[model samples]
Target: MTRFQSPFVRVCWYLSLAILAVPFVFPFLWMLSGAVKSQTEIFAPTLTLLPETWHWENYAEVFSYQPFARQYFNSLYIACVVTAGTLFISSLAGYALARIRFAGSGLLLLLLISALMMPEEVTIIPNFFLMKWLGLMNTHMPLILLPMFGSQGVMATFLMRQYFTALPPELEEAARMDGLSRFGIFWKVALPLSRPALAAVGIITFLFSWNLFLEPLVFLSDIELFTLPLALSNFTDAYGLPLWHLQMAATSLAVVPILVVYIAAQRQIVESFALSGVKG
Candidate 1:
């Protein structure tokens, strides 16, 4: 048997993986432990993985500290909208770019690709002015709209285009023979088959929107409209020092959805990346 197939080798390999994972995993373990620790304990010179005193009330204080629950909901709903919007818009655009022949299509694709290189920091000022002109300030509108058209959206389009470019043309041709219009073929045939790409885009867009900070900071001034990232910062003293216990607790809670999403869709994420990379 190959060395990799041997039980001893397998055990050693797994152990090596565990050892390698500690640096990445320990912060999360520390975060969980620190969530239940007091400020004094958290900043204590001695490194302790477990809390000397379990301050479970810090979790409750997370809600009482600000409009945290509303902020959480804001992040959640915005992420869902951005995810859905990116999927719908990106898929259609990707399909057209990948399969439909038209003048200037190549130029359009090139332009979109160029957009991927332009960081949001460069455009944030222009977008901020535009949103101000439209009277969208102190609202979630910018948060929802900007990302759907920005780098994340373009990346989704590129990924979808790549995936669609790699699909079997025979299936679409067969659908056309059945009296299916282009939209019908796309809606009925191509999209369903592109679930991996869609999932990848959806998950990515959702995460981006959920963790968004800059747009929300610029566009929103209302505490009630704050997303989790901003709200997390509010767990601070008037002197600007973080309430370590409460902040840790809030951060722990804020991270739960992300953890759940990554855990559930990790396999699909890896698969989607692999398939999307095949054509590009």
Candidate 2:
């Protein structure tokens, strides 16, 4: 009789897989559990995989607790705008850097690299003063403008440049032969083939905007103008203590849809990032 793989090896492999998955999977599981669980149940030592007493009211309460719907829309539209702007700005800059032969191209790349390596906190103070001087203080303008021109945009631009640099010159030459301008070839042919890079930029930018805390915290005070992350943190009592139930529910609201999309397109989504040079 032909030998078959042992149950022992299969069990060991499955166990190993489960162990590896815990770090990624556990936080989500906790969020979901915390969303539905009561204040008391959330802190239980054993941990509740399922809600012991499901408090479905938390979902409604999440909205009732603040201007959550408005905040949700704030984060949503900001993310969309930021993502689109980054993709447009990054891709164009990237193509130019990759294809054009201008003086100081290397120096420009160096400056961009420097900006990318520098942490946002290091610049936030000066940026705050700058925003104040420009009359952009306590507005969405800082959130939008800072990121659009900041290291994030630079990173996206570099990613696109790298991707563009890898494309064949023959295509551009063929486009020229076919009476297409450089802009036309770059816009039509190159961009059409660069959908993966675009998707990567869009997704990363969206997540960045969605999860942004420090900028919103420092710049915003109006309840009506708060983004989701800032709004979620605002669910505290008069003593500056947290209201965990509402916070978790709000967090679940903000994060779950993103998680859903990520799971649904895990392969294509992941490949896009990996292709764009952000391996994780």
Candidate 3:
């Protein structure tokens, strides 16, 4: 008779959740199954979930077809660097915007918000020109600098600012009384307590940079400079037909690490959003 033991309610809830999860979960399942399947089996009429023969060599072919291992390294390192840089810069900017009352602070924050409304596509050409002018064309510097200073980073800054603004003023006031300078307080007190916001920002920024395709496509021409997304696309035949087997294998490799990391830190990621919501 208890609500927890209501069979009708439980069934409906479980069924609804299962239905909702299908779209999100099915694509990954398909991707995984496709990764190990032969090209023929992949496009076959039967639409099987498991491969008839698991092409384990598809993985090896992923490496041999191009500088895929190198490409993997490129994506991983770029994502890591972008994540770290975004965290530092956003946290600093966020803390200042949340606490400081200097003239033009409002205008600066407004400008940053306006920057968010501008799509990346609109500015890609200008960005390309800027990068070319700065001698950063065909380099990882554009990848690192663009995302670290673009809408994503600005969004991270706003998230941190909201979290910091919600924090108790007494905490920083006490630190100030103890002769803690602004930088010292930010480094020692504010940053330590802003873990949830930082975690959320880092996770999102890393994933964004990892899956970025267009920026890399435009900025990099060297095969060795290609990231995972670009490298995955390089698996094609002489006639420009996609080599699905190898492409799927490389795609799976590119996605698996990020999937593992997200699953591992899923709890923290959820908590980060909850914390941000409370602050907002």
Candidate 4:
């Protein structure tokens, strides 16, 4: 029988899903509700989903308190650059590792795989020094370069490599028979068929760069260079006490765009993963 034919089972499955989703869904709901609440209402002894009175001015104050617009732009642009760079570098490396039968190619793939086991915290000190030595501290260069060359990029490369390895050899053989060079086959044939993997990589890389906090915290001190995560932490009074209302408002604004994009492209994201999984 079809799943829909069993009403009791379907109800139980959906009910279980709803129960599991509460923890994840409620926090966002509370954040949205809290954004419009006054400081008094936010920390009130009694909890309510909607505030007693909505304080809309909290959003206006968020922008005035810091170089928020500039910081927002910094994050948006940095994430875009990092995503594009990761896609190009990872796809090229992945394709080569998967398709080319060169000396030490297996060893190179093994080394790259080993990198995934190393945590970012272990490399932070060396990376910081490297950035400073290169005069990249307090600049967007480290932010851009680190994610493109770091563990996240390695993960993307492996993902693409898996996807590429699963592709049928006949396609490349056909292209080769047509007298296409290796680069031409990769550029014109393979890459064109790699849209799903590319989308998966781009989405993941973009989100990683967008939500990156530790790298920005260590490399950047200038407010103008701050990404969203760093900027969100700056919502505080002179006494270093958090301006909770303003912070919530700013966070809501920052989160909404990503939420919108995710909601809109969720189907594509799922499809990409499915395609990658099937191929891999």
Best by TM-score: 1
Question: Best to worst by lDDT, what's the order?
Answer: 1, 3, 4, 2
Compared with the true structure, all predictions reach lDDT values of 0.91, 0.85, 0.90, 0.90
For 1-280, candidate 3 gives per-residue lDDT tens digits of 6876799888999999999999999988898898899988999999789888999999998888888889999999999999999999999999999998899998998999899999999989999999999999989999999999999898888889888999899999999999999999999999999987898888988989999998999999999999998888899999999999888888888888788879988876776666546543
**If scored against the real structure, what TM-score would every candidate get?**
0.96, 0.91, 0.95, 0.94
lDDT of 1 by residue, 1-280 (tens): 5865798888999999999999999999999999999989998999999988999999998998898999999999999999999999999999999999999999999999999899889999999999999999998989988999998899899999999999999999999999999999999999999988898888888889999998988889999999999988889989999898898899999999999999999987777667557664
lDDT of 1 at 160: 94
Give per-residue CA lDDT, model 4, range 1-280, as digits (tens): 6776799888999999999999999999898888999987989999899998888988989899999999999999999999999999999999998899999998998999899999999999999999999998999999999999999999899888988898899999999999999999999999999887898888878888999999999999889889999999999888999988888899999987688668877876776556445554
Ranking by TM-score: 1, 3, 4, 2
Clashes of each: 0, 0, 0, 0
Query: What lDDT, from 0 to 1, does candidate 4 have?
Result: 0.90
Clashes of 4: 0
lDDT value, candidate 3, whole model:
0.90
**Residue pairs in clash, model 3:** none
Off by over 4 Å in 2: 1-3, 6-11, 44-47, 276-280
